[model samples]
Target chain A: MLFSLDPRISRLELPESAPAPPDKAALDQFPTYEVFHQRKENTAYVYVGPVHAPEADVAFLFGKEQFSRRFPCTGMWVVPTEAIRVTEYGDDQQSVYDRLPLLPADVLAATDAAVTEAYDIFHLKKRGKAHTHVGQVQATSPEAALQAAKAAFGDQRPVVNVWVIRSTDLLRSDEADRDMWTTTPDKKYREAIAYKVQDRIDRFKQEG
Target chain B: MYGSASTHDIPTQATTGLENEDPILLAEFEARIARGEKIEPTDWMPQLYRKQLTRMIEQHAHSEIIGSLPEGTWITRAPGFRRKMAQMAKVQDEVGHAQLLYSAAETLGKTREQMLSDLINGKSKYSNVFNYPTPTWADSNVISWLIDAGAIVNQMANAKGSYGPYCRALDRICAEEAFHLKYGHDAVVHMATGTPIQRKMMQEALNRWWPAIMTFFGPSDKMSTHTEILMRWKVKMATNDACRQQFLDMYVPKILEIGLTLPDANLRKNEDGVWEFSEPDWEDFKRVINGDGPCNAERIAVRRAAEENGAWVRRAMQQPKAQYVRPLA
Candidate 1:
């Protein structure tokens, strides 16, 4: 029998040896969602990381817990990984917009819609840096959005990469619920600065 | 909090199959690393680099997940309300760290499903120190303070590594680990300074954990072409001996200052400022790591049970027609 010092494990009465279960099937952990967060008011949303979930709502919840639980976040955003169109990464000193193949005016106009759809543009300032929200562009499609982003922020140099996602695809935290970010004073124990260990050690040495 | 500097699966031989790589592409990759450019997921990379990194990151992720079990067992019986709450938070942080690390490993082309499967099947190895059990509250405290301290030493070096996703994940993991170290130190200090019974318990726990802590960095590495290439590529950031010495330099004084004794009588700083201690039994370390440790069966059985029990919920939550895509950093 498998024995453990912890009573909970002991109670489980697990067998000493068991056959390895079958390998998990694909998509067992769900698809990926790219997560971003705003550290404070008026700050640009920065890419924190990614989460796996079934849909947008669960993704937002997981994103909040994963990214915001430890750090102070004023706002957060989660988008499906498939929804974001990424550009080829440029060198550290170069802007990725310069590498964009120009779409002819006729071709751009052909895909133009009466009501422009809003898309969010994020930029990587340098290699290895997280992408940050640059601005929004109105375009009929993701390709047009890239063209519009070039017009809006192409002058900003040193963009190593860019990610464009439809604004409608984002599940962002509501500005109205600002109180959720406020951690309780009692939670100070969780901070590194909470422990006054040196004082006690000093007392022990003095006694010795 | 439990990342070890040593990865068990790294090939120790001089043959790395470098000649098979296209000379031009290999030169560009090496030059980029030399220039301190971080390699993103989509970048062209040598197969050895990818395999080594995936193994390292996956093992680190598994450590976080399994490492939580011993500590999580303490949340119920922690000394008081405040300690209990802190314990719970620390355990939760470890599990969350696993999530972050699993996602980082995924960016390297391995699916999280396959990684978890390998973990339960015992094909992948985590930090070997976790194979031993935490038999007392004081034993748990040793893990919190010293094991976390050791992890920080290893992780701080890796945070500067070349893989962008792994580096980013390490950045976040290190920030949270600061709290764990302090919290552990606080707990250990409180017990050591308490009544005689408490002090004795604390001392006993330290004695029990010192051997495992010595082996925490694994054996002294024999330099090979594989090791040299990994270091140049920024895959293996520091030698295992370097990390172990650094941990001793930072922590030994702290343990002594608290009036506790390390089990090794010969453990002292030498003339050249090196720590000299009894060589941990490599035989025992190998036996434990290879599935003959005191608690190896229990750890795996528990992990397998968790996966088997949770399969139904995972299936229920999986969306129909869902497609798998590797995470983008």
Candidate 2:
């Protein structure tokens, strides 16, 4: 095994300032990808991995490095940065009024129907979570899609809002890639038995 | 990965598409998290989930980035070859860990560069522990021992967290922490039984770190934290006080056995099989987390310098390939 660093602290930045940018801003734009993990068919999709690639395919390598390094998983999904439909939030209206409750119930109901142009996406969460996308799907129209999500999901619990996106637009990793999931300790350094070298150091101390 | 926040306007939930009383949609989403399940990216979820997840993940992402300063300092000053090596590996793991976490956070819909900018500008915050300085070389051992110990305890429980990626990262981090704990303990034991100077170093380091270590878990969230909403939703797996207590129960004895006295005079084990210590100044915890700690400014400055310095590396990666530059074309 090799010598290990203390796991207590992190090192993305340095002491005086940051060490430097880890990758190119634009390079990241093209090469870095956002990872999505599906724990099970029943569970709502969540962001669970990271992959890097200059193109969509390259994302698989980095995504494997990021998501499957050591953690066990049922499935992994990696998509290019451009493939995502992201809307920025917290604008002037937030400061203008009504911070909490998100929206008036009536507004919630009306917008739900009004925005039904087609292909709406919904991100749902019971509690707020990191890697939250709530489950997203494309439908013919936003309202109908929202309706479908509600029928498929439910509206009793707090289902936030629906974001409409065309399914065809979303870039998803091949769900059938069994090979990526099976290649184990061979490729990942951390998974190697040698990674336990520090534990050996601990055992050495305990022996003394 | 930075966002175009300047042009982005916040839209109410209505605009995002919650048109009618979709009772069915709500149920499925609730059923998912309620069954000890993780919500995935393609499932039907409400918009608020994405918004809230974005906020929390961004802060956590920033934490991983800002968290580096205190310990990275000691990488150069670690005692012997073993310590130095251990320190190096640990820091690298942290970088990897941050990458995992930021990637997870981005799923909530913000880019990594955007999160970094927030950290540099002081708009985002990390764990209060990072806001303080590691004043001595021994401080590195203490950080690995205590701070990491506290984090492990929190993350262990968090491995069961509702969100998939955060939980996965926690699982991976927890796996690595076993070695980390041993490294810190090894340091403590090595120092305690080593030279007289080494023992003194350990004590001083503990004295400075003990309170902050206790504060590692945010102050008792009894009065706030919306734990009910969060827990039912799966944002956190346990309560702050409970996790803090668990950390004390597990580590206090270990620290003492390592031949180090905790800084508290009143620190003692209780009749109920719990180790009890004086409450850390909750106010101080707030102050530290709020960016008023001893080393908060210094930590931020270091992060900014590193980010700025590293800009070209990022630029180089993005520069058009020289292979494509034809002669006089």
Overall lDDT per candidate, in order of appearance: 0.91, 0.58
Model 1: pairs clashing at backbone N, Cα or C within 3 Å: none
- In every candidate, what fraction of the native interface contacts is reproduced? 0.81, 0.07
What TM-score does model 1 achieve against the real structure?
0.98
- The A-chain TM-scores of all the candidates are 0.95, 0.49
Predicted candidate 2 versus true structure: per-residue lDDT over B99-141, tens digit per residue = 7666667665566656776777777667777766777778877
- Model 1 over residues B178-248: C-alpha lDDT tens digits? 99999999999999999999999999999999999999998998888888889999999999999999999
Q: Quote the positional error of residue A3 for candidate 1 in Å.
A: 2.3
- Angstrom error at residue B304, model 1: 1.9
Query: Considering every candidate listed, which one attains the maximal lDDT?
Result: 1
True contacts kept of 2: 0.07
Candidate 1 lDDT by residue in tens digits, A1-208: 7778888888998998988889988888899999999988898999999999998899998998899888888899999999899999776788989989989888698766456899999999876779999999998888889999999999998899999999999998887887877764558888898888888888888999
How big a share of the true inter-chain contacts is recovered in candidate 1? 0.81
Q: Fill in the DockQ of model 1.
A: 0.82
Q: Which runs in model 2 stand beyond 4 Å of their true positions?
A: A1-31, A34-48, A52-208, B1-24, B46-48, B223-225, B319-329
